[model samples]
Target: MLLVLAATGALRGVLDLRTPLVVTILANLLNIALNLLLVHGFDLGIGGSAAGTAIAQWAAALCLVAVVLRRARAAGSSGRPDVAGVVAAARQGVPLLARTATLRAALLLGTAVAATFGDAPLAAHQIATSLVSFLAFALDAVAIAGQTLTGRTLGAGDAEGTRALTRRMIVWGLGTGVVAAVLLLVLAPFVGGWFTPDATVHDALVPALVVVALVQPISGVVFVLDGVLIGAGDGVYLAWAGLAVLVAYAPLALLAGSLGAGLAWLWAAYGVFQLARLVTLWLRQRGDAWLVLGA
Candidate 1:
């Protein structure tokens, strides 16, 4: 995971997104093949599945690293790590880590609440969350573009360029969000059966899926602004803002759980969380403070 992450980050810095995407696809294909071979052929069970994934990840990481090294060689770059630069980069990353951790904590809280509602609710929660997570990758593609371009634009001290990029990405994010929302809603009835044959779980899932579908636009804005702020090196603000939203969200989630609310309500609480995120990020994007121009 670490090696792949490093390689992807380096590739993103050079605006080489295709390599990471290709390697990821190859890795998943390799993982499926290895899992079939190890788990069934060798009868290694779950441990074999784990081993297959581990091997696939390592293979992908090595492939990406080789590509990075070759690129460096071609560019005549030293490929040597500078201690001071490393320290500075790590320092900058700390707030990002905090921001991510807080966001994940909120998700965990939702999962915990879902588990309290019993098997069917929990299953529905899992399915809905998984579907939303899958959709997030598509929406996040625009955010990735925003992040890369915003960083490059800001680094060159082009404030107007940064704003222009943000606006363009926001439009893309909204358009993608609308498409996802429409598709999710249109498929909500039939989608649950695809994941499970259990009628109770499927019935429980549709309402929550609808809630998820309704919030795609909010999610879209939140993700893009998040990437934009990160590109601007505004991690400290992001960390604090994320923590604030989590704090605000916890009570809402708890209340829904305590009231024995249905899956839809619980997911509604998550929608509130996303709304909070949108508010914070939107406010930041409106201001000039996040446009810190420099390396």
Candidate 2:
């Protein structure tokens, strides 16, 4: 998992994610083959599955490293790693790390709040949360495009291009969100049945899923703007924005926990959080504040 993460991050930095994406696909394919070969052919059970996964992960990492090196060579860049560059990279990444950590903390807190509601609500919440997470991949594809394009356009001093790209990407994000929302609503009946036999769990999941669907467009706008901010080198403000969101989200989350609010309310807490993010990001984008014109 760590290896894949590192490789993916490295690939994202250079806007060369195809290599890592392919690596992931191939690794998972290899994992399946190894699981069948080991677990079935060798008659090893769960241990074989674990070993297969470990082997696939390491192989994928190595493949990514080779691709990175080859790409560097082909690009004719001085292909050497240095401690100073590593330190500088880590220094630059601190704000992003803080942003990610705090966001994840909020998610975990939501889960804890759901757990207080009883087993059924907690189970339903997990399913709904998982649904949101899976849909996020689709939305993030637009954000990633925004990030790469924003960085390159800013680097080239094309402020107009940067603005246009941000606008277009935000539209794409919203469109993606709308699609996710429709899919979620359409799948509500069948999805709940696929997950569990408990009628209560299924019933609880349906409404929460609606809430999740309702928030998709909001989440979409927030995510794309987040990428634009990061790409424009507004990490400090982004970190501050994340902190402000934490403050806003905490009260609602706490209230939900204390009152044992339904799963929809907990997800609504997330909506508040995403709404705050949209405001923060829009403020930055409204002016030249995030427009670091050169380098």
Candidate 3:
């Protein structure tokens, strides 16, 4: 499963991820069907789940390959990787690679910190993580929309249109975040019960979820700004800014863990990190730095 996942993940690039996303959806649907058949009918259990996931990943990877090839052909280009092009692409991608690594490390470290708080806290953290992940992925569609549209407008040298589009995207992000927060807040009391049976875990989850709900607006702004910056080709700034955000988050995270403040405090630390991101990205948008016509 991990191997297949890595292969498919490599094909995921650019702001326009529609093809890969559709492939993933189809693959996951197949995985669900296979898991039901193999886990129940064939009695393979956990192994069946792993096998299903692996097959789905492979399917997605294949579909991604097909999509890339088709697009290349449609552009009337030779579908072959050139060494010079590959090297240039790799050079451009270095900062993004570093940024992704740091982000992953922070999340892993956060999970480790959660485990130190005991089973109930860890379980509650998992539930909150799941909810956050779902919301993040959903919100990302809007971010993607912002990225593709903004990139196109800027590339066309339409400064006014780009600004208008950015404003619209920001509004979209704000609106989506607020709606998500309200829904989560309204459902917070009962959501935990759906995920776990232990009263202790459920109790720990409510406040954590409330924290999640409250932070949604902040997260929405950060995520949209992140996509907008990427669209504007601000990779170098983003990479460094991500490192700075991580540095800012580290102290708060350490204090949260050291003080034994549990999941709510930990999430509050995450909120701080997102706030830092929002500020940094907003600052970048205030200048003509990214309006370079040829860049």
RMSD for each of the candidates: 1.6, 1.6, 3.1
Per-residue lDDT of model 3, residues 1-295, tens digit only: 4433433433333344555667767988999999999999899999999998888878777767676667668879797768997686677679877777767766776777888899999999988988998999888878877777777778778888888888888999998999999999999989988887799998888888898899999888777887877777778888998899899988888888888999999988888877888898899887888765533
Q: What is the lDDT of candidate 2?
A: 0.87
Candidate 2 backbone collisions, by pair: none
Q: Candidate 1 — which pairs collide? A: none
Give the C-alpha miss distance for residue 27 in model 1, angstroms. 2.2
Q: After superposing candidate 3, which stretches have Cα over 4 Å from the reference?
A: 1-21, 43-48
Weakest ten-residue segment in model 1 by summed lDDT? 286-295
lDDT of 1 by residue, 1-295 (tens): 9989999998998899999999999999999999999999999999999999999999999999999999998999799987998998899999999999998898899999999999999999999988988998889988888899899999999999999999988988888998999999999999989889999998899999999999998898888999999888899999999999999999999999999998999999999999999999999999999988874
Predicted model with the maximum lDDT: 1
> Tens-digit lDDT track for model 2 on 1-295?
7667766766787888788878889999999999999999999999999999999999998988777778778889678877898897787689988888878888899998999999999999999888888888779888887887888899989999999999999899999889988998899877988889999999889888988888999889888998888888788888888988898999999897898778888888888888888888888899898898874
Count the clashes in each prediction: 0, 0, 0
For each candidate in the order shown, give its overall lDDT on alpha carbons: 0.93, 0.87, 0.81
Q: List residue ranges in candidate 1 displaced over 4 A.
A: none
Global local distance difference test of model 1: 0.93
Residue 158, candidate 3: alpha-carbon lDDT: 87
The full ranking of all candidates by lDDT, starting with the best, is: 1, 2, 3
Instruction: Give the higher-TM-score candidate: 2 or 3.
Output: 2
The CA root-mean-square deviation of candidate 2, after full C-alpha superposition on the true structure, stands at 1.6
